[model samples]
Target chain A: MFWQVFLFRVALVAALVIPTPFFLTQAHADENLWGYVYGTDTLPAGANEIYLWTTSRNQKGKGNYRAWDTQLEFEHGFTDRFQASLYLNGRSHQISGGALAEDPDRRLHRGLEFDGFNVEFKYNVLSVYKDLFGLSLYIEPEYQRIDKISGERVNGFGLESKLILQKNFFDDQLALAYNLTLEPEWKKFQATGERERELELEHTVGVSYRFLPHWFAGVEGRYHAVYPEFKKRESDAYFLGPNIHYAAERWWFTFTFLPQVSGNPRIAGRNSNGRQLSENERYEYRFKIAFNF
Target chain B: MGLLSNFDQLTCALSLSSVRRIYQAGDLADDLVKCRLVVLRIKIGFPRQGVIMRTAQWIWLPAACLPVAAISIPAYAATYLTVEQAQQTIFPGEKLAPANIMLTNEQAREIERRSDANVRRKDIKLWKVANGGYFIVDEVVGKHEFITYAVGLNADGTVKQIEIMTYRESYGYEVRNADWRAQLAGKNAAAPLKLNKDIKNISGATLSCRHIADGVKRILATYEIALK
Candidate 1:
């Protein structure tokens, strides 16, 4: 009886802590200036979810501002442990108080296919053991066509692979996680001599507390190392953010702020002429709302 | 005094003492005798009414009388009822026994009819994503559809599982974000799945999070109702 009780408790802790590593790449549009992805852990089979959020980010020195991004997401379980989902996001950036002054017409940018969308498939590879640990794998790739300031159209596909690790301590009230993200992009520039490919690797570590029933707060710091093969000089950006979330019976909401603490300087301009890039990173504020059926 | 008279008096005293001891040890003790005498006293004074007479007349009889009659009636009653009637009314079948659990064909058809009726009644617009799964949009926002899905959670609301029943959006990037959903495994369902909360908001996919979280809440609500 004693061993059984101990095992049960251990299993509960595993269920809460493990299986987090598989969901690390998909970010809420509220906190990120970029679009949204749909790969996350499978909702319990037969369960479903919808999430929406918007956010804006600014450079640390208040230049190179990104506009608010809107996101809508839906996910469902087809079995007891496996789940699938579809997600869509639209983003518009404004050069508010930034060096790119002539970029006021964000709509023209949209015509270049600034918006991106993708589909995701996920499976709970393992969750039935002791429930102490869970495993899942997801794959997602997206494409968007955008017009640069030089009037050149760029079509790019972003491929991302993420590993999420969830660990629990102190009777399942506290959870710690490490997430690794790999993003590779293929870009084709129209009528431009610039190389049309770029890649970024992002790593983040986070800890969350189940402070109240269906409520949680956590802090995550991410380091994004951009390796632009087109541009020889590599750059890395760092962000620190605090998040607040509320999940109700049929809906959920989230808010967060991420300040770009550090970044590398842009060595040279490829498509744009006579442009001076800022050395400082950007800041972001985000909010999201979601409902389930 | 004469010798014979004295002997007779001694014998009478001895006999009385033996009787007293026997009464104390046996069922005819003082408490029983008192209780019996009280009952007799009450019975003697009661009027000859039918109700009182019924008890007065029955109490003196043997205590085994009613039990014997009760036992005999059940035996006779069991023999009289038909097998079907006995099976239905007399006893619940044991584990080894077989019983009917079949539904009529009409009833089965009725269930299917109701399911189709529900599908026709709701405003659901379905779309197939390029990667996988069909999206059912019950609500429309601008040109995009606001899709909803369910997230099954445990008692603590940690994500036990997830299901996407409806959606209409880009499938590639959104579908790739599927792994990101695991971040919600330990989240509190009563709270919001915000970036500022315990979850890590994805860089490009914040908008998708909102729709997914909303769908999760709806699913949890259904689970709650079912539990009750």
Candidate 2:
């Protein structure tokens, strides 16, 4: 009941904020790059945009394991060097087989549900056209509720930040971007009232080339590391992918497919009951479409 | 191996020939070289990818495939019009005397303050037609590129015609249409000349339309103070 009321309030806030007529303009070309590699380019001052995206992760193991997340984002550029965005996120999980098979109530249920809300701000420190490389700082704060397979709920509050750098060559035809991200999260279990903390560090490098007027092809490599208690290194993974982007005057779409090239052993340890704790996903795919008004 | 060498030599020769022509054009040599280099990199990069894919089997097949693709890749070309061509198109067969006007810092600032467009340069090219009219050339920034245009005015300081000489942006080419350019005709110094008011904007070409309209307003103001 509390979750329901919180979700209604978030939806109401989104409704009230979206209709404010502040500004409108066409989207930029570099804005269609991969999600992990934030572009150092900002829209012209007083420009507004809306972006919609879906991400699917396919885990390799057992029976039918996948996760899907969908998000809606509204962004506005208040000044040439400052921009802010709001996001509403939702997720779905497909869990079949494994230990959950023994429990009738937790056996096989796959459906989508509301997840959370996030607010982000980005400030450009240097412009690529004026400086050697573009540099920007970004921060996002998020609140989410996760529904587990055992009918338990976990609520989390998290903060993520990134330092983004980008450079363009050949009259903006070729672009290279790098991002270093850090996130700290705190979660509280509703059932047991237990709290946990986690820290994550991620680095991503991407390169894109505009082969045609509206088409761009690129590749990105990412390295992710996690610490459960902020002190001990728990796990790490590497992902590499190819991305393609297409943009018209007022709309754009981008798709990326990332396969985990390497990671810590999936079967890291076993519980006292001899059940193995496997690693995360094997591959992920993302699709994003955006419209400028 | 022989065929591969020949193909490389052929591309080099073709690139050099185009470079020679660019040099002959003279004014835009540096810009042309930069644009050509970008195109050449893409053309060369794609063929190498194909070669890497089929390296073990039939190496020559990939080299053979290069000519068809390389020949079709068009260079980034920007059209340039000499002053003679612009005058002939604006005021056909009539000789125009060069009356280049140099603006003082205060004059440039006044024009910039009054107009919606930003004046990038201090000197404005003005031509006095044989019939006491004026032909003016100015450049305005549209998005990231510069758009050069020619404007002709009658002796009474009213617009006669406007012609877009060079447009560098990939989109918004519709601003070059005769019907859109015709709307600026007969607009005098006193007119509002504002976008969406006196001039209607093209749906997809809003930036180009607004910048061009703002540019015309600035030029008209320049004519009143400097050329009149």
Residue-level lDDT for B186 in candidate 1: 55
lDDT tens digits, residue span A165-266, model 1: 555443333556666777777877755645556676778766666576556687767777766763554667677788765543333455566666656654
Candidate 2 lDDT by residue in tens digits, B1-228:
255543543233244345546566766556754645543322331222223211111222222323332343233335556667888999998889998979988888878777644666779898999998999988876444567899999999899999888876535677889999999999998888866679977644555787788889999888876777
Q: List the residue pairs that clash in candidate 2.
A: none
lDDT of 2: 0.67
TM-score quality measure for candidate 2 = 0.55
Candidate 1, Cα interface RMSD:
34.6
**lDDT of all predictions:** 0.42, 0.67
Regions of candidate 2 where Cα sits further than 4 Å from its true position? A1-30, A99-108, A147-152, A268-279, B1-228
Could you list the chain B TM-scores for each candidate? 0.31, 0.67
Cα-based RMSD of candidate 2: 19.0
